[model samples]
Structure formats: structure tokens, C-alpha cells
Target: MNITLLEAELRRDEGTKYSPYIDSTGNQTIGVGRNMKANPIPKDWTFPLTDAQVNQLLAEDIQTACASLDRFLPWATAR
Candidate 1:
């Protein structure tokens, strides 16, 4: 599976949000449906990140997700 394609699908499905909101399970989330509980912010992190910051976080989160996929489905990355 292509990581870029996977990321695009995730972005399309999850959508993007600049502001934080509570997810269905009562977890705080921000930036492309990232769960705060799963992806905790730094202790010194602040709320209301700028659009660029939000994009940066989304990119980071996507990378994290791809890493997890690689770990769980090593064959997915095989040619």
C-alpha cells in the first residue's frame, strides 16, 4: 500500500479541524481527528495553533500512523 495514498484517504475520511473538540469517546482531538489521548501534546504545548502549526501536526500524525501500519503490516510495504 502506498503511504501517500493511505494518508490522502485518511485526510479525506477524517477531515481537518483547526480547533480542538471532544471525540465520540470523550477524548480531546485536534487536527485530522487525532486523538489527544493517543497522541498527547507536550506539557508545554498551547492551544489554538496557527494553520501552519496544525498542518505540521497533521503531517507528524500521519507519519506516526504510517509507522504503526508498517509495524503491524510489514507486507503492505513490500514491493
Candidate 2:
């Protein structure tokens, strides 16, 4: 998968958030759609996340999703 393209799409679709906010589903979200309920914010982090931090969270979330696919749907990622 072209992660760069994927990141761009996610940023465009989800938009960036420096501070936590309630999403449409009412989930506490921060960064680039980083669901705080599934993964709580790090204790070291503060309210306003920097661009670098948001990007980091985006990358981590993508990685976690990819890993889940690899484990549960190996055939889907065999490309």
C-alpha cells in the first residue's frame, strides 16, 4: 500500500486535531482520528499536540491497523 497516499487521504478525510474532541460517534479523539477510547492518550502528552506528534499518532495508528490485517487477514495483504 502507498502509505503516503493513504496518509494524505486520511488527513483530508479525518482532518487534523491538536486537541481532543468528541467525534461524530462521540468518541474522544485526538491527533488524526486517534481514538482515545481504544488507545488512551499518553500521559506525557499535553492538550495541544504538535504536528509532529499528530503525524506520529497517524503513523502508529496505520501501523496498528496494518498489523491487525496481517494477523487476521493475511490473504488481504499478500500483495
Candidate 3:
């Protein structure tokens, strides 16, 4: 899979963000609208992530998404 393309699409669709914010449904979200419920932060995690941290979070989210896709569509790995 083209992770660069996937990241581009995610940024285009979800919109990149550096600071933590409450989403429409009131979930604490950050780094391209990553839902805290689905991707929990460390117990000591803080708000207002730096640019590097935001990028790291986006990378982690991308990995998680890819894993999910692989699990649901095993044939994707054969491509």
C-alpha cells in the first residue's frame, strides 16, 4: 500500500491539527482528528502536541489503519 498516498488522503479528508480539541461529538481529538476513544493516549500525555509529536501520532494512526485494513481485507496483502 502507498502510505504516502494514504496519509495525503487522510490529511485531505480529516484535516491536520496540532493542538488537541473536542470533536463534534465531544471526544478529545488531535493529529488529524484521531479519536481518543479509538486511539487512547498515554496516561501522562499532554495537550498542545508539538509538530513532531503530531507527525508521530499521524504515523501511528496510519499504521493502525493499515493493520485494520489488512485484517478485514487479507487479499490486500496479495496485491
Candidate 4:
């Protein structure tokens, strides 16, 4: 997963149905329904990064994710 290609976004999802929650000690049940929609990513993001630069950024982002996810990846796959 390229970090550059992927932007960190906080998405608000709307709940389908009402869900009741039991508080600690079972004093009272609370119903919380409907989740707010996730905000869209900011547009007009400027960058000096090119496609190549973005790819590199993504590879770097995954360095800790799986150890060697980027090791086999290059600009093009060798036959």
C-alpha cells in the first residue's frame, strides 16, 4: 500500500439501525443511533511529488507494515 496514493481520512459512516448499549453495572441502556458521514478529503492539495515520487512515498510507508512488501516492487516487473 502506497502511502502517497492513500490519504489518511476520517470517514464518518451513517449507522443503519439503532443500537442499544448497556452501561457499566447495567444501570440503564442507552440507544445511540446514526453515525455521521465521513468527511471527504481536502481538495486542492498541492505537491511537488510526481507519480514516481508518490510511489516512493508509498513504499516507504509500508516499510513497517510487512517488512518486505516493497522489496519485490519496482517500477516495472522483470520478466
Candidate 5:
């Protein structure tokens, strides 16, 4: 899969938000659909995040999600 394309799509769909806000699902979210309630990184994330920080978080989240998919469905990425 093209990660660059995926990131672009996510940014368009999720829309970047520097400040934390409640998501439609009621989860604490910020920075390209990051669910703070699930994985609250960048400790003491109360302050508005910078673009670099948000981008970093998005990369991490994507990595984690991909790892999870690989673990659960090893054949998925085998091609």
C-alpha cells in the first residue's frame, strides 16, 4: 500500500486539528483522527500540538495499525 497516499487521504478526510477536541464518537481526539483516549502519547498533551508533533503522531498511529493488521492477518501484506 502507498503510505503517502494513505496519509494524504487521512489528512483530507480526518482534517488536522492542533488542539484536542471531542470526536463524534466522544473520544478525545486530535491531529488527524488520533484517539487520545486509546493512545495518549506526547505526555501532558493538554496544549495545542504543533504540525510536527501531529505528523509524528499520525505516523506512529499508522505504524501501529499496520502492525496490528500484520499480526492479525499475516497474509494481507504478503503480496
Candidate 6:
């Protein structure tokens, strides 16, 4: 339940490129960027990202990838 760890995972997966902003009300907005600069914010959106939203997104990702760990370090666990 660490925010830093979740942020690290989000950063690793390029969360900034996807649902960048955590929104003012704990909601995620996708494809909010426009232009070569790859703006990470939406026009109608407001500032301030809540810890809940950011953590939620990262947590969901971690959950989805949980099964992928089985394939990792397989040789060591193989019997």
C-alpha cells in the first residue's frame, strides 16, 4: 500500500502517456493530450490529483499483471 511504489509502477508502464491526469475528482481521463508536445492534461479538466485515483489506477494495473509473475523466474520455481 505504498504510493511511491505504485507511482514507480505507473511511471514504468508509461502511465503519463495513457491516463495521465488523476483529475480533480479522482477520475482518470484518457487521450487528453494534443499536439507534438504530448500535453498530459485535458482542456476541461482542473488541477490537483488525488492519491486515491492515482493509487487506484496503479493498483488495478498491478492486479491485472499479477498473473504475469508466474512466468517470471520460472526456472527457479520449476520442479
TM-score of each: 0.72, 0.95, 0.78, 0.25, 0.91, 0.33
Candidate 3 lDDT (Cα, 0 to 1):
0.81
lDDT of each model, Cα atoms only?
0.77, 0.92, 0.81, 0.31, 0.90, 0.46
Instruction: Rank the models by TM-score, top first.
Output: 2, 5, 3, 1, 6, 4
| Structure candidate 2, residue pairs in collision | none
Candidate achieving the largest TM-score? 2
What order do candidates take by lDDT, descending? Answer: 2, 5, 3, 1, 6, 4
Q: Candidate 4 regions off by >4 Å?
A: 1-46, 68-79
Off by over 4 Å in 5: 44-46
Q: Candidate 1: give the clashing pairs.
A: none
What are the per-residue Cα lDDT tens digits for candidate 6 across 4-45? 675676566544434344554555454322121332333554
Candidate 1 TM-score to native: 0.72
Model 5 agreement with the true structure over 4-67: per-residue lDDT tens digits? 9999999999999999899999999999999988988667665688788999999999999899
List the candidate 6 regions with Cα displacement exceeding 4 Å.
1-9, 12-49, 71-79
For lDDT, the strongest prediction is 2
| Candidate 3 Cα outliers beyond 4 Å, as residue runs | none
| Model 5, C-alpha of 33: deviation from truth (Å) | 0.5
- Per-residue lDDT of 8-74 in model 2, one digit per residue for the tens? 9999999999999999999999988889999887899997999888988999999999999999999
Tens-digit lDDT track for model 4 on 1-79?
A: 4343333321112111222333445432211121112221124423433454443333443453345434555533323
RMSD after CA superposition, every candidate: 2.2, 0.8, 1.8, 15.5, 1.3, 10.1
